[model samples]
Target: MGADREGGARRRPMRAVACAAWGILLLAGCASMPDSGDLRDVESTPRQDTEVRVFAMPPRENAPPAEIVQGFLEALTSDDPQYATARQYLTPTASRRWRPESSTTVLADGWDIEVDRATAHEDSGDYAFTLTGSKVARVDEQQSYTPLDGRYSQSVHLARDKSGQWRIDTPPQGVLMGRSDFQRNYMPVNKYYFASDTAGGTGRPATAVADPVYVRQRVDAMTRVVRSVISGPTRWLDRVVRSSFPTGTALRRDVTALAPDDQNRLTVPLNEKASRVGSERCWEMAAQVLFTVQNLTPTVETVALQRADGSTLCTLGADRARTVATRGPVKRPEYLYFLDDKRRLVRILGGTAGTSVEPVPGGLGEGLQRLSSAAVAWDERTAAGVSNDRKDLYVGSLVQGGTLGNAVLRSDGKTEDDRLTAPSWDARGDLWVADRDPARPRLVVLEQGKGRPVEVTVPGLDGRVDAVRVAADGVRVALLVQHKDGTESLLVGRIERDGRSGERTAVSVLGLRPAAPDMEDVTAMSWAGDSRLVVAGREQGGVQTMRYVQVDGSTPDVPAPAALTGVKSIAASDDERLPLVAYSEADGLVRMSSVAQWQKVVKEGAAPVYPG
Candidate 1:
């Protein structure tokens, strides 16, 4: 019965849990619960009653648990040194998920990791038994918080080594970058996360942990940052360029023409702004993103190219400018900081840098930010790209595997339920899809055909499967599942190539609760570089977060712990390498470890390194 019932819904929903109130008193009823501190291993567990018979507390206003987890995970590989490696965890897209300006003060001063533990309790169907973690804890007085309105509501970050064991890694090595064994995982529709709260005293009045004055001050400061970053968006578009037309060149009647003069002209600002103290020379090309996705109405953000030098090539967005998308563009970039010769940000932008996020009624910091939560992928083989000979960026939504490639953008249907998610390309160029089908959500196989779609199913995924990853070799598949109750589980299964429903051979369990918080479902996932799978979760509220989870190895420890969880929605590459989007609290994304501490912990752990 245990096997047949799939844990009998023993676990609750794996959706992202936002501990917006860190001051959660552990819920008084928790006293009757097991003592996780006892280390008695009573088997950590969350209730499974789908029915809401128990109210954990006064039901204070709070962020979902998923948000907290996602924030923490992104915080792990927080070092700029971890960027390249971490980028692999991101899907290939052209949208930003971070606010460079917000991170400038953060990443510029990166964290050193110190992991305490990275393991899941159990996996019952999609529900995970227990997934808890701890860190060395920080004492950043300026950043530290107390309680707000009798409750604890502070920006949260965790410190843990998803690497499991410790080891030294190059930028690329930080993630599963350039792994020869893995396949190139891709998703077209870029996902993003937003941290700005629309929760203006919504629902019931919630409590805060930080002193109301301090919290208000911090919020006001962030508000100023937001205002500063966005002010340039409109001004840059109007004053910077139009006012910089060369001398008297007859300005095209089509483009807004303003003659450049000492009075109103602008320069790269050869000031000490981003100049290094002692560097002899600096190369500055694409000083500004010629045009941003918001200009063209981007579904996701593919921003930034961190150079070998400490300096980074990033997109700079301004909110004051016209939000110019197809219908209406958004006016924010996830991260706001940029690196100078000294690896410091001279200017910071605002907006999400994620690849799978939906622009929720967002715009110029005010308007519905539209997102094409498609989660599709293209490679050297698909039409989504220019050619195998060219470097082209294509964005697509998830389509049923059966309808994959066959239709450039065709999904079974865009009804309330049939939306594409986690679309990936296989070696054979066929599309293997993880159907979000509520009735019978199975792995749908889609190949290029002439007239109509020929649908097939994978018997292995007969129940609630969240996300699926096909190994680089195309012989294996990793499954991220969320049982009905809200638990999480991971399983690696062998894929049979028979014409009939492929047979599945279970290898070993990777993690039971890899994507908690946003565990309701995994919206985006891919093989990052070699040894890891970049996975993203869809929160119960429809938002998702990204995760760089470890893949199985030759040993008992198959699926390892998740890097981040608990956010609205996110997307990542397989090995946790390429980052279409970095983590940001403003976007509701989580960073388990603080940038400074995560780097430190991994070093101390001298942890075992996984091979690509």
Candidate 2:
């Protein structure tokens, strides 16, 4: 009864006067007299628009235990502010203790309610029901969503009040709802913060990293997102990112419902704790706010920070904020590079189809050392290519008279398939590659493509690394791992560097989590945006398909990209304006245009990649 019962046989008829208020009209037959020969269920179409608000009905007088439980579950999924109606089903003490906003548990389907035969009976003063469902994910008090796969079972106790009305005395602490309702009621927004090590100055702009969180869509989202940004980054990203706001920073007392003015300017009044910061730090704080707010609404063009006493701290416009804290790649890639038919590095103008393909300006492009796969640095000034046999890796300059040097690294894997995968570069200019040697597999990083290769320690790793892709942020790395049973999964790990100043550092990849848990076999993947990756993989019993998944292990609300067959490798830019390029076995090297159609770029090319 706790599940969605609107389409069930137990549907209740609404009063005529309340029909219009609910935005639905109930029609009843007045002249029906004949008995039905065949019984068929009549189904009502569900609302597809999120802007349509659904209000929960209050509990009926003298309601039974089951109805009270069902009504409470329904109310949790409504757009009612503060869930006032839902609390009515609970006793005063339980209502006060319940914090619906504390967290949200989302199930694959609405919860099932069944009375406990051991203690529940019609004449019993207290009744107990077990609510159960398959837990799919959860959003904590911080609004951070983490994927889960397990069963959820909670006991809900109801007792008869003095007036003989049933009320819940033991309700779940936080609200629980189905996945469909959660998606409809909440929206994901990115809160921005500066990378810890990349503080702006000295010819380098501090890079902004996106921390995504879910918030109720119609519930003063602007103010909630602003408060979340001020609170600081989530625990997972707190180590690698930092906020410019001072300790104990918060919004001014009595401040709520922050909205932009007619001029598209947002003024945020901070508490006294943030009042003493210098002008430069205040501007950085404003940059964080400006970047975070822009993702929520496009109308906000500028953000002005104010002290508790109403004195202006700093003001930042969208244009200046970008200069202070840049997002994504520092420089746009000029060309999409890949290996040609002869295993030589070649390139074509990015985002353009039918353009003349030319060999890149570097020694690797001369075809002297046939290459299997390659990656170009973000600056487009250097390139790293794996040898045709996939054993030796070479790094060379992209200059007119550049010459190929000796292989900087090598793998001892007996066969090509178990050797070095394609290399990738991060914004910090460091190169990352994975060696799939079964005897001794390792994830290695070249510090600025020089010095000894740092073998990254991946704790809790249960498989060998097959492919590697480092994100533009330089704080996260994505790896395609092959399990013992031969199944491959896509995982993202946090890149941590620890050591003393001016001393040798220890680099490791920690907290490896599945980014595409449902994909049975991930053939390829690429970072498509700040926190989104475009993955090509197959489900347990499904065919290969390409979809976007967030680094936090959640699927995005947007539609999947157009399907391409036999995708061997894929390439995408953090800049969404650029088209997606991939090497498909059926169609050769191809790129998806702005119109969502794949256009052939070359008849024979592989390992398509954009400068990381």
Candidate 3:
């Protein structure tokens, strides 16, 4: 369900005095501007770490049709909680019928409003205006954001009411605003769920997957997020993730506010539907709440689930939550691995400086099998490497005497560029690599890094897969697809495995969507967090740049990492504390330091990677 549905029925109103005070301050600021000066460009204020409350002005008495329309658009961008002021611009019936939370249409710029001449007739007491702009994205009812590239045009109708005041009669169904306003009004938060294939209470830890969604920054956010958790994962991720909350679960009807206590413990009150779950299931439910809530605020260290009758269902703390469900890789990698000057696998401690690079303890690292690129497994005990020729893939252990096995997979492409790409490991120990052979491109995975390769079916692939990086959760894969126009775009797809037992399980990548749609060429990318990626690419007609993007295709609120030139391959650990390692054409292997500056790691190296 989308936020604020049912006409913001669940939303609480902001204090009237607070809204009035903010209005006075806004007017005062506008009144204080200099009357005359040479016009200078004013830089936009940086996004605030704390919420910025905005209260839009209501329509003036006897306002004109254009003024009414303009007022409504501005009000949509305010933090008015229930958006009561925005509704004041509409007729009584329209206000009652409008569903502002149905969805949000974000345009590249604020919409252009112009009178629709054919439909605007002063004598008829009616006016029609069209809203036009370049649509950049849309947040659906489930709060799943999707990048869009197209024109947006919507018509709104207004008429004079009995009070001789202009009011909108046919307002747009959902809220609409520009990208800047959208950013100011919403913030992304991750809701946690266990992988559909894993069960929580088992001996093995259930893998937690992040399902990101946007919510109003300060509008009873904790309560809204809790409700979203009860509503379940967004539609796009529903098939691959499962929420522990029972079917029809929801917050008790009268429960509208949720806050952590002084000790940073939050108690969620659920409806009767969740009152009868088993203790194990309730703990899983609490674990889900803990993980989800912690992302909103690190201070929330524990979550206690309570039934509608005010009885505790289960209480799970952050420490215990980790054991019940793991997010991304369970362990931080001891060292970052890469191909050294000798084309052999080598390693350096993750967060230390002045550390000497040393060969890994294995045949692949013994300078015997020259490697083009490599991926260390989740446990750091095993590694997969692509031969220097890019035609063969080898897997070996990190033990001192371990020998590299014969090629487990081979590409018969005619040239190095057309052969296998670099390999990536997932949390499940499965290895993924794509063969870029033009005649027969294939995305294949090796179960446990052994046995016959299982070709992954990509249903809507329109180009050759140039690179593959499976996220540590093992449910999403990032692919660099080369199009016919010679441009490469980064796309993310969901990994779906059929419910068949044994080695013959069916696997396919579905719902492939552009993760970096604005980029004309995505040269390199890596998963930098649970649902964020560090991407190096260039926009159309723009210079190459590095930025962080969420899996849902939205840019992160934080600033981009320190800039670097000619980045060829980038690698990052889900543990963001570790430095980012990248291979640059101009600087060889380098890593970002604690100061956010890129420092040379070695005079010569390539394909730097941390354990998956």
Candidate 4:
């Protein structure tokens, strides 16, 4: 929300080959070499200008029923004011009753539009066609989108008018479009909600979760974003987060626009039903609005809630709204921690003036050996690691006099790829891991550093999990899975824990769903912000690219840094504003700071990571 801009000018090709690579990431094999020599001198391909919203062409006169239907569907994707041209294809009564803004179903490319002429009667002057395609996302009545399965079929009915001109008789209420049209016509916007609860240990206030949804790029986007937040969280995340807006909340009558005042404080008018709530509830709702608006438009620094008469109910500033919802560990250390050349854990203080890196003054740093990948607990007292051989998984103390313990979990040492993935720590101090060992391919959740590992049941999980990352809330686990066909994808599942009070002894995964279903060949992933992740992998069969994707699989329009080609690993703070750190073949260990430029942070470093 700071200087970070979403959806810059990065352009994806309109060709089928380009989309095919992005849709499933069908890679023949992984690339072993770097793609770019100088990260600073590289320039991304220029994007085509897609800002022109209104279409120049209108419905042709005396068009047949099929052509009229086609013209209407295409016209719906334009930015024409009031859709005056599109309405010409519909009967007067149908046009009056139809609302294109009701909902939107985003479909995949290459959909077949078939007109059924088999049943047509010569005298009836009526025709029907079918639209069939795989869906990517569905924007519902309130405009909240859920990224679940998108296989859809809709029938369009057209009839001739009294004047003998073809017009839509029973057009669907909402709109539908293919992915390419969606990309060029719509834009992704995030609606803010609160985390389910405060951070467990430190009592940090609940943080805001940004739910990414798409809306018309130039048409009433602000209105759509606000309305969706008021409606509630999307279907996929309803159980994971909370919203302050009341159940029956709505915008006040006669208020059709949202604009910032000269002072940059945006005033929002809610219906009288919302004004009936108590002051505390009102403030919370105000925080939700403040956070949501600020993300969409950065110039808004404050938010004022008001009623129909325009009398301000409450005024909230940006500073207080920023920390309303927290994610990740309760207490993040001042330094970014990673494994050093000596095979020990080290820290590089964040925001420190000079670039001096130092190792932890403890047994964990001195006693550990042959370390390849490591993760520090939120408390910063415990550390977990996998041996360079990927055979052993260990958890130990990070303090001065503490000992480096032996492996709590081990993998089949048959091959390097069969070894365990680097461990992940949850807010409850639970350690999570997955073994690619085909003989024992399974996910385990260990209680801190002791007890038997609990095997999580993943229903319909078609492949072996390669890496696992648990969210700070301890309810979600992000996994990178390799399918039977050798293609990889990023999936997130709910960790079903058993225990309301005391220590939880049982854990399992349910509803395993792909976080980025369309993206394949996912190599690395880490929690970047609340309900968001920075994924590193190739959408195409080439060098890996990095982008910040929503946990629900929706990618924001914001411009992410250029792809760190040949990147082996990457790490980021739960707070989005913090600099991102990563290890790559080209740069060794590098960091992106305030200027958002990548620079070397350490000459010899590997497996960089952050706390839970």
Candidate 5:
């Protein structure tokens, strides 16, 4: 090679080259290497003396306390027709919770926000403050703000982004309403507790059977609830009753008690004379505790959650359900009830049922697997209820999978009208179920339970919900709601608590462009990175994908129509991660950073479409 190099054009000798690349992460003032991507730098201890606590200042002192207080009032009232505020100061995340489909929930003017003092306790780029004010609903005490009427002092938790501007973690969770009872209140022995079943509609209603509210109350309140920690599984109930209860104003000697030892038995009986059915409680998913007997078939039972304890919590009785059912061939012996944490009954679901009933499991697959397979056959016979009283109504929950999460698909009735639309969950963890009704339309939020689902309400947008999405944190949610008179859109809101009431705030509304006419609804929405949402489902194999950043209703900054080329399933990556799109038609999964990068993945080969 040396001789050849003398005559021919010799290539330069390739040397062993070791390349080194370094990244620097800057925090405070010092720079250090971090694992990568938007994780807010985690730095090692400093070499010298500096106290972070000393520098911490409350929200009002560091910045104008007035602006912080005003911003919240403005955002809160933005939805009110009387107090329509502009959308300038909202951050992208804040705007997501501020989407309003209907009117914004407001605190009537009678409630004055006279900020007594804003003491900035601490600041680490993020801010925290303690706020006190006198908030009163209108003296008239109407439905608008009837529940909250009084003065209160509350802790205000706020956060600041890289921009150094402070914002509330959520105005809803921190706000306090004195009049409302539970959902927040709890202690050693308090009558008030969290409630669920409200105004019926959890399942079917109970017949005119005696209400168990009094009985369950006696159980939770009169019975001394001893700690299971010292003992195990609740055996302590016997000891607690023998030693602590029985004397003074405690339990009456005449009344019989549920033996602690009875818990081990498959079926334990409650004293019919002493115990009554409690109101039934429902969750957003599946849940039902049977009220067939005063005694529950040995299972761990607690009082159902309600708005507040001691307050009138309505639960459905199984027999009541048959009477209320729009269709009948009413069967009794129904079994199901929701009890409060105090072991008081909340509601009755399916009463002691006839032989036709079956136990509903928590997971989707477990439910479907339980079917005898004959339920599908149109043929009727004398076998396992397949012929006449089919199990379809009870089975098709479209439940979330056991661990990974999946949905059960079942129709309530033999006819098509009774079948539930396929249930699904979006990028944000909020549950999205297809609507069955057109006019008084309803899309139920199913909370998982051992027996039946607990239906919870999403305020602001009611019924006709085309799609709903919970944020990465199941706490925040967005919805694609359908309206009468032919209107549809993206409605974003967050769950806030005013004392006991579950309040929702509408942050923004998404308007579909006529240019993309064929797209009927925004079936899937993923908040890619910060301000952009990668909207899917416009055309068929046509796979229309668009990214939108909201500025206002008039002008949302959208990239060129072709920003995303032939996109399919899209997933927004978390901090330090690149958003991914599944173009199954081309490859399978395509990774990208921004609009430009996503365009590159599409240009190379399109991903296949996800099953609609």
Candidate 6:
């Protein structure tokens, strides 16, 4: 009876549909499926102009203090050129004081703002409000990106004017907007900075360094980007990087905008202050300008520097500009390394037709077995790995006939999951590892030629450090930390070392910040290019995906090609053009080349790794 009743109820919807369609064809419920050959993918979304403007509602006449404040905040997200609409909510004095270009604080959406009414007093009409939200990143006065995490609060006060209208009497400088508004209002562009390879002895050619920063998409973006490059690196990077632009540098007084000629030649006029640099420094400065501008408009193939007198001081073309001070002495690796089916180290050399897979030579190549994870040094002379039992970490020579030394490090974890993570070797030959033993977690660095490991402290991390990868520069370290809440976070922190003294050195992590906050369950990450990391993770607890993210935690506008699903590990060289290598469940080990397609490189491999 229940089955029949259920069948009757199910047929009621079909009967109603057929009855409703009787006038047309009386076959609505029996419509045939479309032909398989006729099926098509949805049309791609139309590309949007980078400088497109977003409109915001204007302020109403004689609005209350809270309403005026809300309108002003909303208008800040729109492209009003000079923020004319937003200024209406401010007093004349405050309007002149509020400089929207001073800085930008990007907040996550869905922030709740509370407005507190004032009690009846001498300033009874005054109102106070508080803003609270997650800080994603900040563009300082110099327009450099600084990754920020945690909640932020600001108290804003508003007052009623004598004309019976509310206005902001004291307003803050710059602007604050949600990430959604920020995406619509601003676009990211690269600014060039010179290489500061503190660990350069490993023998690798110098490569380009592109510092990603955000600028107003449409409002004089070219001019703004160039000026920002001349302003020098951001505060977080100022001490670790160098710039060619001299102090007090600026554009020529007569020129208001940077324009390219028909033949694709862009001429930038500098004030007398910037003309004092030497020829080599001048070339670097030109390269900086060229890289910054070309990132915006491709029409500019060449750039010429001019003086206040309109005289051409120097000219740099695309070919020579990219080579300026960017070449190092070592060749990049042609093969991606990994662990073979026998748990021995192996490699797959990439080529045009296909790749040749072979086992690496040496004790690690033929003798070592049951390896869980590994890392090859930047010099390609040494390697490190953890035993399958997860109790021993070994360092050995990477060349043929080389020996796998006794376990240099050991784990105390009682379970396999709590064992040591994969070892990573820095450019300076220092091997880093994290013992994930829940009973006694630790982060240690095995300096070259040292018997014991040095413990490094991660000050503010409220979790266990799971993995570690130090940058080639030896100044920054990337850490995969498992938080107390059972979620993993990717963090980058500065590696602060004690000044060179007569005694031995000490190093610790300070000012640790999130590098990929938008991602959860990040399984693997590698340095893909300067200040950029290619990460593999599941976002929002969905299927795993691979993407390139900035070290400053800002997502790029142009998305990277998606990696094959279920990629267990990923490896990338600092050279951005080189293909990325990964190990997946279906396609053993594959290489993702320039075409953004995965080609099988190794038939059976696991734990793929690349030299730093």
Q: Tens digit of lDDT per residue, candidate 5, span 1-612?
A: 011111111111111112223543222422122222221211211222211100111223233323454344323321122112322233446545643322212122212232222434234534334333344321111101112324544444455646666655534332222211111111111111111112234465321111111111122222322111101111111211111111122222343443322442111221222132233322210022222122223243332212222222233334443333211112211222111122111112221111232222232223232321111001110011111122232223322332313223233444433334333332222233444444334544433212333233554554456544333322234455565655656554433213243443222222221212224445555433221345655543455555542211111223533344445444442232333443434443344544445332323222111111
Give the per-residue lDDT of model 6 (tens digit) for 367-475.
Answer: 4456888888877777887888889888878787887768988888999889899888765678889999988898888887237888787899889987787776555
Q: What are the lDDT figures for the candidates, one per model? A: 0.27, 0.84, 0.83, 0.70, 0.29, 0.71
The order by descending lDDT is: 2, 3, 6, 4, 5, 1
Per-residue lDDT tens digits for candidate 4, residues 1-612, read: 112111221111111111223456332211111222211211211222453334523556676554566567666655664677678888898899988777887766523455656534436887776656677776776555557565676776777889888788788667776666676667666676766644322435665566666767676677767877888877656766778777888888877888888999888898876776665566677777777777678788888888756777777787765455443456655667788888887887765434687887665577356787888888888888788888988787877787766678889849989879888998778888898898889988888766778777787788898899888766678988888888888888766555663565456677666677656677778888756788887776556688888776677656887657678888888766568888888888888867777888878888888787
| Model 5 score (lDDT) | 0.29
**Models, CA RMSD each:** 25.8, 4.6, 5.9, 11.3, 24.2, 12.3
3 or 5, which is superior by TM-score?
Answer: 3
**lDDT against true structure, model 6:** 0.71
Cα error, residue 120 of model 3, in Å, equals: 1.5
Of candidates 6 and 3, the better by TM-score:
3
- Candidate 2 lDDT over 329-377, as tens digits, reads 8878888998899999999888566568899887999999999899999
Structural similarity to truth (TM-score) of each candidate: 0.28, 0.92, 0.92, 0.80, 0.27, 0.77
Tell me model 2's lDDT, rounded to 2 decimals. Answer: 0.84
Candidate 2, backbone clash total: 0
lDDT of 1: 0.27
407: Cα error in model 2, Å: 0.6
Q: After superposition, how far is residue 7 of candidate 3 from its true place, in Å?
A: 33
